[model samples]
Target: MSALAAGQRTLSGHLLAWALGALAALWLGFVVVGFRTGQHEADELTDGHLASVAALLLSEATNDFADPRRVIPTSDGDNLRAHDYQQSLSVVVWDAGGHLISRTGDAPLPPFAIAEGFATLELGTPAVPWRSFARWRAPAHDRRVMVLLSVAERDDLAWDIGTQVAEPGLWGLPVVALVLGLAIRRGLRPLDALSAEVLALDVQRAAPLQPRLRHQEFEAVVRAIDTLVARYHAALAREQQLASELAHELRTPLASLSLHARLLRGKTADEAERQQSLQRIEQDALRAGQLLGQLLTLARASRTELAEAAQPFDLAALARRVVAEYAQAALDARHELVVEAPPSWGLSGHPVLMELALRNLIDNALAHTPPGTSIAVQLDAGERWLQVCDDGALAAQKPAPAPAAQGAAARHALGLGLGHRVIDKVAAVHGGRFEQRPAPAGFSTCYRISLP
Candidate 1:
């Protein structure tokens, strides 16, 4: 994943986890509250029913007070009502002095202060949960009857109710978590689309970003990217402008230097002075031509729209043509130039640039080698090479070696008499390198341009 996408996914994962936890905590709290409320309502209803029963019994005991023997046996008759209630209740009756006069069941009633109204209390050996209410009755003038009713249910029932209340959250939590995860992923779709669009952009073409955001959230980010791209274009244009101006400014000084040297050559009348001036004029003209050519090449090479028209052409034909064209100059310098390109040799490139590059190589070879040396241009098909060799100074003075094994250094060194700027630029434009190697006969220079 890209850095942006990975970061978004991490954020979503953490958010989903936190949301699920928070929702689960809230669901648990609601379940707990519901369970407690349900238990309170159930206990209240049971306590109210038991309280009515206690009141009815107290009335019966008061009515039968005149005949103690007819009041029913301790085990049978009217006391049987107390026995029936004893199944779920423990009853205790007391006078105003806190003395217990009537009792039913085995569990002891906790100590209670005598009061005029009802009060609830919990009881048991293992501290059983119960609801107890005391009823205060003053039937006659100064006599009072107190009845306490306590109902006990098993602890297991309370737990069962609590578990029942938590059922919904247990079943629904995973579903909510899944939904949240999907929602987070869906919400980040715009960002993913935006990243893909950005990656598709090509700096050369410099097309504008698509205005295709799915939501308003990414408006600022998209705008910022667009602004940055505009700035880059502006910067690139400025650099190109500066390069053009610098190249233009150098041309005038070069022209003036070439003109002055040429003018001085004719004015010097002495044979020695005339010869020296003529040599200086030729050297300065060559240098001026070289600098202008390099500036032009550099300007055109970087243009994106600039493209070479490539075609298949006979390598030997092209090599022979350049050698034949420069042969007269070779003859004038007392040199023997030979073309050794075979008819079967072939290569392909932009014809015009290749011609320029081959001509520069020929010029450099002729300028450096001594008179009467034979220069041969050979097209080797087996090695896919066009080799130019010279039989002068090859085993003696060689040019600088190539920077790297793959990097071919142009051998344009001519003891400061010839300029290298033109040859280097031509090689660069043709995407080739120049190298001079030691030969048994003399020095040989090769201008190797890769064919596309």
Candidate 2:
């Protein structure tokens, strides 16, 4: 399977597999331990019984029996056939000269090779397998004793004991598995409920999800989702505000255009009167055009795709170029336009948006302040700051700048609400911000864009 497919199992499937697998392994270990323990114990007991029989027969031979030909009967003989005693204990007593003194009817003959300790061997005419223990009587008598037990019957007893011990656990496995499956399903129900709530949520009217349970594992996820919804709500509000503000901004200049047209409607109007009305109409047209242009620039700056297109360029060179382009209009308005910068201070930003912002800042200064104003474009290499500083109208009289001054730079400073939002959008797109304050020295107002 592909790696993705292999990892696609449910959380419950993984949990159950691990839990049941571990339990099965533990169960198997117990069964194996029980089997080995029972086998070892059965061997020890049967071997002990063989040794005891040898000792008893030898004891009688030495103390009581004068003739070795007498057969010694076992405590539980043929009458105890159900106990399989005939296959269990078979004794053979012998003389030192290798003559059989006495032997059980079912007993295999003595092993020829050795006469001491426990050994497994095949003996007698047909060579039937037997487990045997041999011992010699004290040196005075010169007699040997060997006891035999059937190997097959001993194994059956050990296997039967192990089966009895393991049978209950084997039978209980299915019951245990069913209970474990139920437990795992119950444990995951909370997560399932949370998923259902998330799916049923209304994004248009998003609200914070109140945590139904105090589960630490899901707290972080819930908080993140709530934060995302909050941002979405803010974006919707911004869009609505933009539409309302744009309509209000367009109303003033359009009304002027309609009024100027009325003033020039009749043939009775003189040439000078007609000329002035036409000029004012043209000026209002320009104002309306500039507002639309600012809105367009804001829209372009807000594009997500353009944000990723940053490239290296000289900010100082860019600022000088913007000033040079606007120089003729500044000269016409009798205003001073200058750029101050280091030789070639490098920076990285989207060059198109930077140019648009510079245009807006210069345009704002020209329109808001009076003629004879000094417009200084400042660039700081070390701090990555760009500023446009302009001298406001003299303290004697606060009047509007000339027609030449009214065309371009938008002051991001206080009072021009639409212009403020335009500069803010441009600055945001550049990963920077614009601020306006009283000029430190030699100027009245200063607008600055700082990029980190």
Candidate 3:
């Protein structure tokens, strides 16, 4: 699988998680606050009502004393007729001398002395507490009245009110979640479309992504994908061009070898001619082998295989070694090969790529220049540059136009080819470039692979 496929994550899943989490948090917060507030309001109303009832009862007791005929009723039927909340409440009236005047309901007696105004009476353990309120007649101070209610009953009422407040949200949460899920899916529709577009892409004919996306969030992503696709297409084109060039380069050598082989097999009367034919076949084979090797090196450089094998080495020493390898070839061509560089200097890069680049440069100089031409291999450690200069008339000439079928060997003969491109690729991978320019004597070409 591609890295892109392996690293894929669902946008809708993330959006849904965040949306549901935020909604749940808000719901919880509202439920807690509402429950507490409802309970507090219930307590306030119940306590205030209790105090008011106690005061009213004391007033009624004072009136009853003024007129004995209308004395407050002690019968449950009469008390029930007097108040709406009488089912959940109890009342008692007492004289100033501590004599019970009247009472109603099954409420327990006060756990403490009757106070003048409002007060709570806990009639049991803290875990199962009951509550009551007492009031004494103010002007006459001749009577006291108390109203009682259960703590458990009051709590039940508060809880009912709180649940009523929270009922709508609790019931509607699933619907809200469904709406949020749909919204998140709709929001991510563009991403799904983009994914489809990417999946339909043909790597060989890939093009930049069109900026037809409506969402701004995906603009950067689409542009990045376009850039990546463009790179893939360029790499593919380079590989195809390399294959074509390799085919073309192999054709001539193979033809020459076949012709020589046929001539040798014809069994000429002259042994010298037969020997020359064999030599020609061998030379053709060697040429083909050399071309193939250079092509392979170019392919490895293009694929970035060399960069993966990079290590620290002496740049100056690598230069000297490359120059030495070509010294014999230079001598055979009657050319002077000279190296000018530092004793030792360190650099981090693929030594194989470096050697291949340097070898290509030296070979290009040798192949293009005359036999007596003087060639110099110069390395500048500080600048991280390697240059090959040849004082041949052809070195001053412009390189021939690239053939339809281009390869390292053909390019070397014309002073520019696959070898130069491979060197350029190497320099680029190392964060630099390959340059060709005029030299003091003829022409100089250089590769600068900068060190970081």
Candidate 4:
């Protein structure tokens, strides 16, 4: 594939990657939050259970607290119950005087307060830590029968949570990314197919593109490609037609010139014969010049910058001057040339280009017609339009089409090869159009140069 094709493909890939990356970031954020939340929940459950156990021991010991000896054994039993029995917890008990009486295992006791009710405490230092909940029971009527129980455990709730909480997506992330990547590739398949279609196209076969873009997001690109294909096909057809017309137009004049030159070469040519041959040569040369000029005009009209330096000008005065210049030619052909434009008629465009387009039409009509034909120039002005038209007047009104007509017209339309290039370029730059139509009597061409 070409660089442009690769760039387009890469663009789609980039977009897919970006979208997926954003989703992944959001998912990861949720996962992090979920992990933290799970740890917090585990800590709460462990603390809550320990508190319940402490509360149970406190209730049991409260009955025996009147006598120190009786309460000591029960307190020891409570400590053992929390530690030796439960594999995950440690325990300690303190008397009403804040003296440590019993302990379960070698786990250090959390630095709990001697006050009544329950309290959570962190043991060790800030650097290394363990935590526990302590329950202190001292009924209002029995100040001497006070007891304290503490349930202690190592603080690794976060680690325990990691082990217990199941993440359904833990093993599914890679799989999901792979699936999404594949889906992205599949979704963009239509673009690849469209590229291949365009690459295979040529002037001879400018087939319209019909790619299956499953996603709505890609529809605009597909439509644009299709529209481009259609325009390309139309342009190719026009080019071919122009070529045919060029050949036809040049055939008769070229043949005549060649034959006359051959005749002069064959015999001992007299001065008169030589002069006749030379005159024919000159005539043919002039015809060739005329054809070349028309082709050039058409080329100019199709150029992208055909009217870059356009300026406002009085349409009426310009028309009068053009008509005056053609007055002598019209009279020679026994035709009348008249200009009918209002003094207020004004327009904006490249004056030279506009004059060229108008002159070509008049010259073409007069050249094909006989003497005594009437031609009138008229300008119609409106709020949005400035139109110029010519009345058909002349003999031989339906002369055979010129060989260069198609070349001229096609170039004129697209500003493609030569003359049309100039016209199209100027027309585009000026934001204008060139129109030609068969006149009621002969033919008329109009150049509607818009004004700001």
* Candidate with best TM-score: 3
Clashing pairs in 1: 392-442, 394-442, 394-443, 409-434
- Order candidates by lDDT, high to low: 2, 3, 1, 4
Instruction: Sort every candidate by TM-score, greatest first.
Output: 3, 2, 4, 1
Model 2, range 314-394, lDDT digits (tens) per residue? 878888899999998778666788998999988777777788878878877766666777888888888888889987645
TM-score of each: 0.44, 0.62, 0.72, 0.60
Let me know the TM-score candidate 4 reaches against the reference structure. 0.60
Candidate 4 residue-wise lDDT, 263-312, digit = tens: 78877888898898987876776566656665556545444232356578
| Residue ranges of candidate 4 with Cα displaced over 4 Å | 1-16, 61-130, 138-154, 163-168, 188-203, 206-230, 259-277, 296-359, 362-386, 390-452
In order, what lDDT does every prediction score? 0.58, 0.75, 0.71, 0.56
RMSD (Cα, Å) for all candidates, in order, is 19.4, 7.4, 7.4, 8.9
Model 1: per-residue Cα lDDT over 1-452, one tens digit each: 58777567465677777888898898778877878865665555555666676667666645323332222223443554453223345556666556555555444555656444455555667665455556655454223343334344423444455557667767777888788889988987777788888899776665678765357777878788887787668647844764565467556556656665666656556777666666655555655566566555444433411455556777677778888888777766656788876676655555565566566657766666655566777666776655567766542343433354112111233223222433444454445554444443444544444332
Return the lDDT, model 4, position 10: 81
Clashes of each: 4, 7, 0, 32
The most accurate candidate by lDDT is: 2
Error of 2 at 122 (Å): 4.3
| Worst 10 contiguous positions by lDDT, candidate 4 | 141-150
- Candidate number that wins on lDDT, 2 or 4: 2
Screening candidate 2 with a backbone cut-off below 3 angstroms (N, C-alpha, C), the clashing residue pairs are: 360-410, 362-409, 363-408, 363-409, 364-409, 364-410, 364-411
Q: Sum up the clashes in candidate 3.
A: 0
